[model samples]
Target: MPISQDRPFEIIVLGPPVSGKGTQAKLLAKTFDIPHVSTGQILHSIKDDIANPLAQKVAEFINAGSLVPDELVNQLVADRIKKDDCVNGFILDGYPRTLSQAQAIDTAVKLDYVFLVNVSDETIIERISGRRVCKNGHVWHIKYSPPKTETVCDDCGEPLFLRDDDKSAVVKNRLEIFHQNMAPIIEFYERAGILIRIDGEKHIEEVFQQFVRHMIYDLRNKVNRSSGGSPSGTATI
Candidate 1:
């Protein structure tokens, strides 16, 4: 099916830490010729912008090592989606961490799809535990993308060390917290029938191919039917 120029595609990617949601979202945005709007990236960029009042408000909380309030996050997202770049469509990542945040966005826009990149807890642990970082902030995975020299960064030639957060215990703890926080939000989307689950344990390219196939299938079905149902299924591609 062809992408309609009449309506915008609003997509949201949700996943646990290290589940590759950000990468997948980026791919979707690029393929569809839309912007990848990542809240984490937005927050990081806003910290340095002293001119915008909202940026100043966001910076204060970030500098104080405090979580940005749901209201503020919703406002930021609402404002972001209103930008001219988002007129065609946008892929959203790293926002709506809570039920309130999700509901707030619900009022602002109707989403076409909400994809959850599902990976097993064991897979997440292995993926994160294998990560190593250099002092210069270069990242490498021991199993997937190993450095040219063991424990040495390819770019900086510095010794790579395991980040404290990458330890097995910490990864497990983060997974637990992620599930606890995301449960309600997931349920909300599931009820709305717009939630599609993708198996994230596959290789990166294969995972992206799954996304492409699913999008084509869903859009084609919607074009065929008078009232297309929610595309809810695990990606098999």
Candidate 2:
């Protein structure tokens, strides 16, 4: 069925940690002038709003540096998507980590697209292991965000240190856990026929441009088909 252009469309981005989902979602949301709702950020922002038993349990898990169960996460996402800002449309990131969560989301909102930024496990480890942060709030990637001078912030002249969590061993463990949880979710989106895979190993700007183009194309096709016109692949924005 063709999508209704009169109503706002929701976009769901699925990817492992450090696969640039957050960055890409932010860019797409900015270009489309929509809200970028990240579940992790949302939970962090509302950490003090625990009024119910479920919220208390979620808080406990978060405080323990563990992931919240899928059910609670889905409920949080569903609640957030009903807000006024999301009425116009929004990008969802870091939710739907399991097939059950995906089914719950299907009941809550219509996902126009499910974008998967595909990157190898090795690449992800390499990309995240070199991340460094400075005391002055500057971030640098050893391979990608390198400073002009080694181990020093180019802007603030502060010493740059690797985050303990960004170490290779920790990152590898995280990746393994993510794959174990995410494989079925990916399959769910695939069966839904809305999955769009994009190569994430490319430069950040290149990936952003490709995503924008795909969005425009998909929106245009949806609109055209809804109006009883022959579907054309061309899109203009």
Candidate 3:
């Protein structure tokens, strides 16, 4: 459905590290004319705002090589959702990494849907392990998307290196941490009855089709029933 004029749409997209949640969320937000609010982007947006005390605090933590604690993250999200653009609705790509953050979100905004892009652990490993990066942030997967040169980025002509975090051992540890942190948050949404599962191992277009099947097609049906819009009138283009 198109973003409603008054209420709009607020969606939360979740997935593991290599699951393409960010990619899909950006596309969906663009298709529906809404903001794609990612926590990482939010942090970066504020990091240079020296006058904001919270931004100062967040910047210090990053400069010191420390993670921004959950309380600050929650506060940032709560404040972000109240902005004027978000009044129409927005797609939240990242945030609520813990149960505490999820609870904080409960008091912050009413979400329309929470979509979990589900991919197998094996798929995650393959997707993340075959990776290479450059100083300019050009990333490539050796098997699927190799650079023109073995040791240089095609886009920037910069030397490519194996990111320490993209190494096999580090990928496994990251996946483990993901499961440990995401399990409770996933269950929290499941119990709330707004969680929808999107199979993410398929081709990108196929995965997005599945996402729209629930997010747009399903919501359209609900809107039709509630407002007397014909159920048959709302067809996927």
Candidate 4:
């Protein structure tokens, strides 16, 4: 576990809705020059490939508004990480929701860090509720991210509408389901001693910097311990 350059920085960033999991994951993936792999987006891309039968199957479940089965998801995930880009490591978002997938992922690769971004349920509700979007793809928030004009897209003059998923009842239900399903996955990583909890309620910049600092400190400590206090603590690009 000295994390030689031969191995990539495999990371998993997870959290409840509005916890900024994807946002932070993307930034870190860029910083590390690795792919930001999102299973949800992967499923979407697969759904668009009509000629591929397995991809079509993934599409069928999604088109029916049903949850994709874990077996298929696991297969897709396993296949995804084997691609060349992932050889340099990848930041994962929205995968391994269940213990089975978590175990499957472990068998496939050694994850460097499993970061869980935590935010209060109340803050999640507020963050989701304030989000608004227009048909033109412009998004805004009511409080901290308001548009230049009230309730209207500054570019298109289109009225912004709240997403159904952002409704209080919907968000609450989603959070409940997420935590219930993610409990075992979280426990799995914790038992492995690679899980790191992060505060997701902080400003985006603050959260990103805090995670980077913690990552560097812990990684350096691991390297030094494994190298018997040598210069392995200093990582090179």
Candidate 5:
């Protein structure tokens, strides 16, 4: 559907770790003045509201370092998208992992697009493994944004160490698991003909621009086809 004020832009940004989908989602949400509905952030925020029973249950699972059940997650997401901020639509960062979850979302709202920020395994490994952080949680990539001092935080002079999760082996394992879970979800959206893949191994701004160009191009084509080949003058994003 052509994005308009009346029709909300229900979008999903999908990609493996370090694919920059989160960054692109944030950009799209900000540019479109919509909410970035990240399930991970939603789960984390719910932990603070100890009075709500749902929040309490979610906190228990989070605090115990266990994944929340899919049913609970689906319910949480359903409730989240009903909020006023999501009326104009929202960018979903990481909710529908399983086919069941995707179908659940389908019943709630029609997704405009699922943008896959495509990056090679080698690039993902390189991008993730080069990450370093300090005690204060300041992050820097050794290759992209190194600190003034080697192996140290610029702000506090604390030694920066590689996070266990950012290690090469751990990243590889995460990629394997992500693909296994994401394959069917990708296929589902692809079959529905809303999956848009864009190269993400470029500069962050370039990646965002590429996504926007694809969206505008495809949306204009759609409008043209629906309007019997004579596109409107305002056929722009």
Candidate 6:
């Protein structure tokens, strides 16, 4: 089906930590020519902006590798989606971690689809526990660790350190807590019939391509039907 340019489409990308939601959302937004709105990235971008209290709080939590309270995060998301760039369409990542947050989002804006990237707990731990980052903002995973320099950043020669949340014990606890909070939200979306599940254990490029195909196919079908036209029943290239 062909996507009409007349109406906007909004999508929400949800997943556990280290599930690659960020990468997939960015790719889908580029493919569909829409803005990618990451609540985390948005908060990070305005970390130093003093005018917004929520931004300040979010920056503090993010810098410490902790999650922000749902109420504050919801407000930040609502504020971001009201911007001009999101008028046409938007892809959301890293928001709505709880059922309340999802309900808050429904009140703030209309969502057309929810893409859920599912990865095993073992895979998430393997991906996150081996992670390291430098003060200069470079990141590396021990399984795919940086060069022989070891503790030094290959690009800047600065020291690299393990993030507090990436420590083995912390990662385990975080994943457990995440699943506890996420189950309800997953059930909510499932009941809505707009949830599209994708396996996140695949190669990054393959996962990204699959996400793009799903978004294009779904959005085009919605547009076609909105115009009172029949579906083309063809996959997007």
TM-score rank order: 5, 1, 4, 3, 2, 6
lDDT of 5 at 103: 81
Clashing pairs in 4: none
Candidate 5: tens digits of C-alpha lDDT, residues 1-237: 222344448888999888899989999999989899999898988889776579988988888999898889988888887778887888999969888998888777778878888999999999999999999999998889988875999988899999999999999999999999999999999999888888988899999997788778767877798889975454232
TM for candidate 4 is 0.85
User: What is the Cα-based TM-score of model 3?
Assistant: 0.84
Residue-level lDDT for 20 in candidate 2: 92
In angstroms, give how far residue 237 of model 4 lies from its true place.
23
Q: Rank the candidates by lDDT, best first.
A: 1, 5, 4, 3, 2, 6
lDDT per residue as tens, model 6, 22-75: 888888888778889887677777788788777677778888998777888887
The local lDDT score (0 to 100) that residue 84 gets in candidate 2 is 75
TM match of model 2 to true structure: 0.82
Candidate 3 per-residue lDDT, tens place, 1-237, comes to 222344547789999987999999998988888789999998998999887779989998989999899899987876776678776688888777889888777666667889899998888888887888989888898889988877889998989898787778888898899999999999999999878888899888999898777767777788788898778553343
Least well predicted 10-residue stretch by lDDT in candidate 3: 1-10
Where is the poorest 10-residue window by lDDT in model 5? 1-10
Q: Each candidate's TM vs. the true structure?
A: 0.87, 0.82, 0.84, 0.85, 0.87, 0.76
- Model 5 TM-score? 0.87
Q: Predict model 1's lDDT versus the native.
A: 0.86
Summarize candidate 1's per-residue lDDT along 83-185 as a digit string, tens digits. Answer: 8788777888997899999998887788888989999999999899999899999999988899987789999999999999889999889888999999999
